[model samples]
Target: MISRRLRETAVAGPFLSVKGLVFGLFILVPFVYTFILTFQRGSLLTGMRWGGLSNYRTVVTDTLFRDALKNTLLFMLVCTPVTLVVSAAVGLLLSSSLRGMAVHRALIYLPSLLSVVATGLIWKVLLDPEQGPLHLLMLRGFGLDVPWLTNGTVAIVLLAFITAWSTCGFYGLVFMAAFNGIDTELLEAARIDGAGPWQVLVQIKLPLIQPVAQVVLALLTINCVQVFDLVFVLTNGAPGTATYTAMWYVYQNAFNGGSVAYAATMSVMLLILTALISALFLARRTGADADA
Candidate 1:
C-alpha cells in the first residue's frame, strides 16, 4: 500500500529535518534530563545525591500533592468547558456578517496576543480585594466585596474563568476558521427544508466542527492541568495554600524548597496523569459522539 507521507511524518519525523534536530535538542533532551533527575535527590545548588524511588515514595504519601492533584483536576474540568463554550461563542460572533465585525474580532482576539504572565498580572490587579477598580465598583453597586484571590473555591473558579477568557481569543479564531470552512449550500438547504437558525446550528454546524472541538478540548485539558504562571502571579497558591495546584506544588519543591529531584518525580507523575486524562477524555467523547 502507498503510504501517507504526511501521516507518517507527523507521528515520526522527516528525513534529515532541522525540526527533528531541534526537537531532540530541546524537548527530548530536557525530558530525558528531568526523568534522570527523578531518581536522584538534591538540587544543583546543594549538589546531587543518589536516591532510588525515595521521591516516588514521598509523592505517594504526601497529602499536599494529593490536594494539589485534586485542585489541578478541578481546574481542568472547570477551565476546559468554560474555554470551549466561550471560544465557540466568540467564534460564532466573529463569523457573523455584522457591521464592524473586523474591529470586534480584533478586540476579541487581543487577549490571546498577550503573554499569560501579562494576562495574570492584569487580572490580579483588577481583582484586588481592596484597591481594585472592579472590586470598588462591585462594592458600591452590587455591595459585594468578594474575596477574589483569598477564598479557595472563589479563587479557583476565578482562575479557571480568567484562563478561559485569556484562551478564548486563540481558540475562537480556530473555530471561526472551522465555521468558515462549512459549506454554505448545506446551510441553505437546511433553511429551505424549514430548519431554523437554532436547529441548523445544533444539527449541522456543531457536528461539522466536531473535529476542531476535539482538538481544542484536548489542548484545554492539557494546558489547564499544567497551569502555573497565573497561579504564581495571582495568589502564589496563597490563602493558606488554598489554591495549591499540582504544578504549583512542584514549583515550590523545585525552585523554593530545594528538592529538584522530588519535583522531577512529581513532574513525571504529572506527565503520566495528563496523558491518561487527555486519552480518557478523547475516548469518552469519541464514543459518546459516535453513539450520538
Candidate 2:
C-alpha cells in the first residue's frame, strides 16, 4: 500500500511539486534561516558575523536575563495554579443546575473574549492611583493609594491576577467539558456508597479529570512563560525589571532594541524551556497511564 501511494504521488507530479515548494518555503526555509541567525553576531542594523557561542553565553550570564527568567518562572508559579483552581471551581458551579446559570456563565466568560491589549488598558485605567475606581475604593477602605503597577512585587501579583481573570473563562470551559464527560453512574454509585458531594468531587471527579487538569497546567505554563502583550501594554517591564519576562526581553532585543541575534538566542532558550516542561508533563502522564 505504501509503495502504491508513492507511485501514485510520483505520477501526480504537479500537485506534489506545488506541495513540496510550499512546504520548503513556509516551514523548512524559515526554520533554517532562524537557526542560522541565532548564532549571527553584530548589530541587527549594521552587519552579521559568526559569533559561535558568544550570544548564548552573553544571554545566560546577563543579569537582566537572570531577572527575566526569575520573573517568568514566578509568574507561571502564581498564575497557573490560581487559574486552575478558579477555573475548576467555576466549572463545578456551572455544572450544577443553579438559577440564572446562563447569565452567570456569560458574565464569567466575558473577560476571555476581550483582546489582551484592551484588557490591559482597561485594568491600567482602573488601577490608576489618582482617579481609578479600584484605587478610590482601596484608598477609602485602607486610607492608602497603592501603586498597582508601580511597585515591583505588587505589579507582578497584579499581572498574575489579570492573566488569571482573562484566561479563567477558557480553562473553565475546558474543565466544564471534562466534568460533563464523566459517567453519571459513577456519581450515583458514590452517593449510594454514602459519599457526600465533597467526597464524590474530591475522590471520583478530580481523579477522573486528572488528565485534563494536567493538560490545562501544561498549556497554562506555556502561556505564562510566553506572556508579553498585556505586560508590555501595562507595565513595559517597569519597576526596575521586576516584570520583565523572557518573552518581554526577547521582544525588546528583537524588535524594539534591534538586537536580532540576541533575541533569536533568547527565543531558542524559551523554546528549550517550553519543550522541557512539556516533556516532563507528558512523561508523568505516560507513566500514570502505564500504571493504570
Candidate 3:
C-alpha cells in the first residue's frame, strides 16, 4: 500500500506543481502587483513615488470615472435581465421538436462565433447613417434616416442591443443544457394538473432553473461591467462620453492618460464590485438550495 501510494504521488506531483507555477506567475502575480501599484504614482519614464490613497481619491472624484461607472451600471441593469429572458426564450424554442430547429439554433449561434472586433466592425458598417446598407435600405424603403451612432442615447441602446445579440446565443446554449437536465416527470405532472403552458413555464420550469439563471445573471453582470472591446471598436465612448465603460476608463488612464496608479485603483474597485455581485448570487443560491 505505501509503495503504491508513493507511485501515485510521484505521478501527480509534477503536474500539480506545473499548474500552480503557471497560475502563480500569471494570475496571482499580476493581481498582487496591481494591488501594490494602486498606492504608487508614476509611469515608466518617471520614478515612482508612494502616494497612499491619493490615486483612489482621484479615481473616486473624477467626473469621467463617475460617468464611466454610471454607464457601466446602466448597461448591467438593462442588459442582464434582457439577455436572461431572451436566452431563456431562445433556449426553449431550440429545445423544441419542431422541424429545422437545429438549423435555426445554428444560425442564431453563428454571430457569437465571430471575434468581438469583427462583430463590432460589422455592426459599425451596418449602422452607418449615410452610406451603410441598413441605412440605405431604411431610407429607400421607409424614407427615415436613423441616427444610430451620432446620438448618445441611441448609441448606448445600440451598444446594449449589439451586446445582447452577440451574447444571447451562448447563454441560450447554457439555458438549453439546464432545460434538458430538468425532469420530464415534473413537467408532465404540471400539465396533468390542468396547468396551461404559460403556467408550467412560469411556475415550474423557471423555478427549477433558478440556479442556472442566477449563474448566468452573475456572469452577464461581470461581462457588462467590464465591457470594453465592443465600446472601443464601436463608439470609442463617443457622443460625448455617453457610452464610456469602467474598463474603457481604466484603459484610458493606464495607457493614454499616463495615470497607471489611478487606473489600478479603479481596477480594484471594479474587482470589488464584481466580487460582491458574485457573492450575492452565490449566497442566494445556497439559501435557496438549503430551503429546498
Candidate 4:
C-alpha cells in the first residue's frame, strides 16, 4: 500500500501528463532563451554579440534599476497583504448562506473578469482630477481637489489597492470554497461553547485553512512581483518614477531602450526572486506539516 502510494506521488511515469509536458516545454524554451540572451549584448540595430557578464555588472551598478527594484518590492509588500486581507473579507462575506449572495458575489467578482486594460482604463477615467467620478465627488463633497494619480505615495498605494480590488475576486472565491469546506458541526460546537464569531474564526476556521492561505499568499507574492500592465496604463512610471515596478523596468529596458540582453539579466534576477519566495513558502508549509 505504501509502495503504491509512493508511486502515485512519484515524479515519473503517471505523474507527467503529455499536455503538462508540452506546456512545460513552452515555458522552458522562453526561460532558456532569456538566460542565453542575458549573457549577450545586442540591439535591434546593433544585432547580437557575446558580451559575457558585462550586463550582470551593469545590473549591479544601475541606479535606475535599483530604484525600480525598490518600487517593485514596496508594491509587492503593500499589494500582497492588502490582496489577502481583502480576499479573505470577500470570501467570508460570500461564504454565508444568506439569500441573494450569488448575485452579490458575482457583482464583487465582476472586476476579475474584465481585462487589465479595461479595468485600468476604467480606473484612469475614474481617477481623472477634472472628470473622474471619484475625484469630482471628493471635490464637490469635501472641497478638495484630491491628487488622484499625481502624487507618488498616493499613486503607489492607489495602484496597490486598485490591483488588489481587481484581482481579489478570484482569490476570494478560493477562500469562499475554503470556508465552505469547514465543518458546520465544529462551528456549532464552538458557538455552543460560547465562542464568538471573531473568536471562532480566529481560533478554528483560520487554522483549519492555513494550507489554502499559504497557497494564496505564495501566488499573490509571485503575481505582485511581475506586475506591469496596470502600471503601464495608469502611471507609466510618471510623477518622477515612483511606480516603476521590476517588470516595468524590464519592459522599458527591453523594448523602449533596446537593451534586450541587459533587460534579460534583470528578468533572470526577477525570476530568481520569485523562485526563492516560492521555495520559502513551500519549505515553511512542509515544516509546519512535519511539526503536526
Candidate 5:
C-alpha cells in the first residue's frame, strides 16, 4: 500500500508543481506587482517613483473617478437583481421537460457564446438612433425618435439591459443546474401537500437554491462592476461620461490619460470592492447554511 501511494504521489507531484508555478507566474505575480505599482507614480515610458498613497488620494479627488464609481455602483444596483431574477425565471421555465426544450435552451445560451465585443457591436448597431432597425422601426412605424445611445438615462438603462441579455443565458444555465439538482421527491411531496407553483418556487425551490443564487449574485456583481469591453464598444463612455464605468476609468487613466500608477490605484480599489462584496455574500451564505 505504501509503495502504491508513493507511485501515485510521484506521478501527480510534477504536474501539481508545474500548475502552481504557472499560476504564480501568471496570476499571483502580476497581482502583487499591480498592488506595488499602485504606490508608485509614473507611466511605463517614464520611470516610476514611489508616491505612497498619493495615487489613491488623487483617485479619491478626481471627478472622473467619482463619476465612474457612481456609475459602476448604479450599474451593479440595476443589473444584478434583474439579471438574477430573469435568469432564475428563465431557468425554471426551461427546466420543464417539454418537447423542443433543448432547442430553446440552445437559443437562450447562444448570446453568451458570442464574444463581448461582438455582443456590444451587435447591440450598438441595433440601438443606433438613426439607421438601426429598432430605431428606424420606432421612428417610421410609430413616429418616435428615441435616442437609445444619445440620451444619458436611456443610454445607461439600455446598457444595463444589453448586459443582462448577454449574460442571462450563462446564469440561466447555472440556475438550471441548481434547479435540476433539486430533489423531485420533495417537490412532489409539496405538491401533494397542496402547494401551488408560486408557493413551491418561493418557499421551496428558492430556499433550496440559495447557495447557487449567492454564487450567481457574486459573479454578476463582479462582472457588472468590472464592465468595460461592452461599454467601450457600445457607448465609449459617451453622452458626457454618463456611462463611464470604473474599469473604463482605469483603462483611460492607464492608457489614455497616461497615469499608470493612478490607474493601478483605481484597479486596487475595484479589487478591494469586489473582494468585500464576495466576502459579504459568502458570509451570508455561511450564516444561512448554519441556520438551516
Candidate 6:
C-alpha cells in the first residue's frame, strides 16, 4: 500500500510542478521584470542600470505627468458616475415587461461587442469637425460647430461620453443579471406597504443590489485608469496634452518616446494607484459590512 501511494504521489507531483512553472513563467516573471525595470534608468535597448529613486522622482516632478494624472482622474470622476447611472437606468428600463425588449437590449449592447479600434474610428468620422454627419447636423440645426476632438476640455468630455456610451449597455446587462436575482416577494411586500415604484427602487431595491454596484464601480475605476485605445485613436493625446492619459503617457515613453524606464515607472505608479483605490474600496465595504 505504501509503495502504491508513493507511485501515485510521484505521478501527481510532476503535473503540479509543471502547472506551477507555467504560471510563474507567464505571470510572476513578467511582474518581477516590470518591477525591476521601473527603477532602471537606461532605455529598453541600452540595458538597465540601477537608478534607485531617479525614475520615481522624474514621474513625480514632471509637468506632463501631472497633466496626465489630472486628466485621468477627471475622466474617471466624470465617466464612472455617468456610466453607472446610465447603465442602471437602462437595466431598470429593460427589466420590465416591455415589448421587443430583447431587440432593444441587443441594439444597445452591440457597440460594446465591436473592437475598440472600430468604435474609435466610427466615432472619429461621426465627430469630424467640418463635414461629419454629426457636426453637419449640429451646424445646420443649432449653428454650433462643436470641435468635439479639437478642444482640450471638450475633447475630454467627448472621451467620457464615448467611453460611457460604448460600455454602458454591457454594464446594463450586468445590472440586469443582478436585478433578476432579486426576490419578487420583497418587491411585492414593498408595494403592499404603499411604496411606489420610485420609493421601491430608491429605498429598497437599490440597497439590495449594493454588492453588484460595488463591483461595477471597482471595475469601472480600473478600466478608467487603464484607458488607452480610445485616446490613442481619437485625439492621440493632442491639443497640448489635454487628453494625455496615464496609460497613453506610459505607451509613448515605452515605445514612441524611447523612455522605457520612465514609462515603466509611470506604469508602476498606475499600479500603485489601482492598488490604493482597491484598498480604499475594500475598507469602505468592510466598514459598511460591520455597520450592517
Per-candidate TM vs. native? 0.89, 0.91, 0.96, 0.90, 0.96, 0.92
Judge candidate 6 against the unseen true structure and give its global Cα lDDT, from 0 to 1: 0.89
lDDT by residue (19-60, candidate 4, tens digit) is 678877898788898899998987858789999999999999
lDDT of 2 by residue, 1-292 (tens): 9999989978998888999999999988987787788889888569899999888999878999899989988888889899999999988888888999999989989999999999999998898877899999999989887879888888888899899999999889889889999999999999999999999999999999999999999999999989999888999999878889999999988888667888888888888999999999999999888988
- Residue-level lDDT for 290 in candidate 2: 92
Once model 2 is optimally superposed onto the true structure by TM-score, how far is the C-alpha of residue 122 displaced, in angstroms? 0.8
lDDT-best of 5 and 6: 5
Give candidate 6 regions above 4 Å deviation. Answer: 1-19
How much is 2 displaced in model 5, in angstroms? 5.7
User: lDDT per prediction?
Assistant: 0.89, 0.90, 0.89, 0.90, 0.89, 0.89
lDDT of 3 by residue, 142-194 (tens): 99788888777777777888889999999999998888888999999989999
lDDT for 213 (candidate 3): 94
The global Cα lDDT (0 to 1) of model 1 is 0.89
Q: Which residues of candidate 2, in runs, are more than 4 Å off?
A: 1-28
What shift in Å separates residue 2 of candidate 4 from its native position after superposition?
Answer: 21
Counted clashes in each candidate structure = 0, 0, 0, 0, 0, 0
Record all residue pairs in model 4 with backbone atoms less than 3 Å apart, i.e. clashing: none
Candidate 2: C-alpha lDDT:
0.90
The regions of model 3 sitting more than 4 angstroms off are 1-3
The 10 consecutive residues of candidate 5 with the worst lDDT sum are 122-131
